[model samples]
Target: MTIHHHPSNETLATYAAGTLDLGRRLVVASHLDRCDACRKAVRGFEQVAGTMLEDLPPTTMSADALARTLARIDGLGADESRRASFREDFEPGLPACLRRYELGRWRWIGPGVEMRSIVVPGANDVRVFLLKGAPGTRLPQHSHSGTELTLILDGAYAHEGGRFGAGDFEEADESVEHRPIVSDDEACICLVALEGRLKLSGFMGALLNPFVRL
Candidate 1:
């Protein structure tokens, strides 16, 4: 698949530094799984981070620090093995990064539009969901109150930002305001991570915003 859109360098750097929130991290991880270019970029960032750590002044540690660190490393290896096993048995249609989350049932939000909430443990105000639009459907025109990351899982849609196909990752902030319309050929399924509430515009969006909880 040809991925035209990707996470910005700043976002990737934040992700590599483990500073991005869980919701946004999951979105970026999903995109990275599909886009090799982003994966290479992330690896480069990690290498730089490692080099920086190596250059830092050395510090003394407690007597049991080494033992504790070794134990943690062993536990992490076990956790990774379990995660790999889970990914192997995960749903084929969903992204590997999303397999760990609990997905709610799909609910209709608008004509030809359905949303399924993904519950991330300990998540507060932020929200994550799988949004699917039927062919030729036009989503409400709206702007984000905070950052919004969208990763296309299937089909395609077009907005002012560009025409996004499968594997495309779009990042939108408060400045963006556009209505996305799914192509006529097939339904569009996307994984969306919202940092804050969506600021919907127009009569239709206003009427549905409160009920949609988007």
Candidate 2:
């Protein structure tokens, strides 16, 4: 019921610019659903973008550029309704709604890490990946080649950006190698949208390489 952590400025900018992939967008949208502050920021960014577009000098563009821009906007609207409906159907955990998600049953991967990934509908390279981190444990250091979004469904994660609790949204940049310490009493459950595989760092991470596919 209280205000939670907001998305980074970079994330708000990317979402406004319409360059974020579907997987990541879902995370942002999910958080936006719960965080009013971030929802307002995203809206402000959109208004700024609209103003910038309106300010552009009238110039004839190559037909291709116009088509490409419109196509991108259209793509953004495709599943807005479906995703909104799906998200609205239930709270974060509901057996019936999860059965419709198609993410594999929860699979344990280590002493403290367990997850399942769901392929986003109509998306080719994007996937909705879930992770449950046991309390007092730290997630491995990993970096992404593309954008990644994380929404805390329950518990929390402490990283460079700071603590993120339930309803908090995080968008990790390409340059950020993320390492999050999980809360102690409850498992840190998160919904992440990853565009591609992750690159793990350090010795232990290397040892866990095969099993730690992002």
Candidate 3:
């Protein structure tokens, strides 16, 4: 599939530097697994980071540090290696970065819409979840308190900005406010990492906001 959207360069740089939070990092990883261009961009950022590190002054380390590090590396199992890339065997009908996560039951949030919470370690303010919208489903019009990262896994959706098909990545913040409607061809499934609350608009959204946890 042709990917029409991607995380911003700042976000990719942060991801390459290992500074992004777990939830956001997982979202980017999911996109990287599907988009070759983003993967190349991230690799370039990593190379830049490596060069910067090389220019820094060296620090003293314990005489046995190398051995200890090597031992730790050797101790890592197949699962650890798999996490470094995509693992097809981990789970079915889910993104590679999310295969290891425990997906909660799908709960109806609105007409033709369902949501499944993803159980992530070190649970914080970030809300990580899966959203499936049946054909022709129109989601609530809303913005965000902070950042919102969404990765389309299956099918497609469209809003004012553009159409987002499978493997597309969308990033929005408080400045964005639009309703997404699923394509009529099939259901749309998206992996989402949301920080802060959903600032739903309109009277209907205001009424639902109190009841909706997302």
- For candidate 3, what is the total of clashing residue pairs? 0
- Per-residue accuracy of model 2 over 74-178 as CA lDDT, tens digit each: 443434444434544233552222323556667877668998776567556877878899998888888888767778888887988788888777766578897
lDDT of 3 by residue, 50-111 (tens): 79968999999899988975554332223443764554443356765576677688898877
Worst ten in a row by lDDT for model 2: 89-98
lDDT for each candidate structure: 0.83, 0.72, 0.83
Candidate 3 lDDT for residue 61: 86
Query: Which regions in candidate 2 have their CA more than 4 angstroms from the true location?
Result: 1-4, 52-91, 94-101
Put down candidate 1 lDDT per residue, 90-111, tens digits, no spaces: 4357876577667888899988
Residue 137 miss distance in model 2 (angstroms): 2.3
Q: Return the TM-score for each candidate structure.
A: 0.88, 0.73, 0.87
Candidate 3 at 4: error in angstroms? 0.9
Q: Flag clash pairs in model 1.
A: none
What TM-score does candidate 1 reach? Answer: 0.88
Candidate 2: residue 55 Cα off by (Å): 5.1
Deviation in Å, model 3, residue 47 alpha carbon: 0.7
Query: How would the candidate models be sorted by TM-score, starting from the highest?
Result: 1, 3, 2
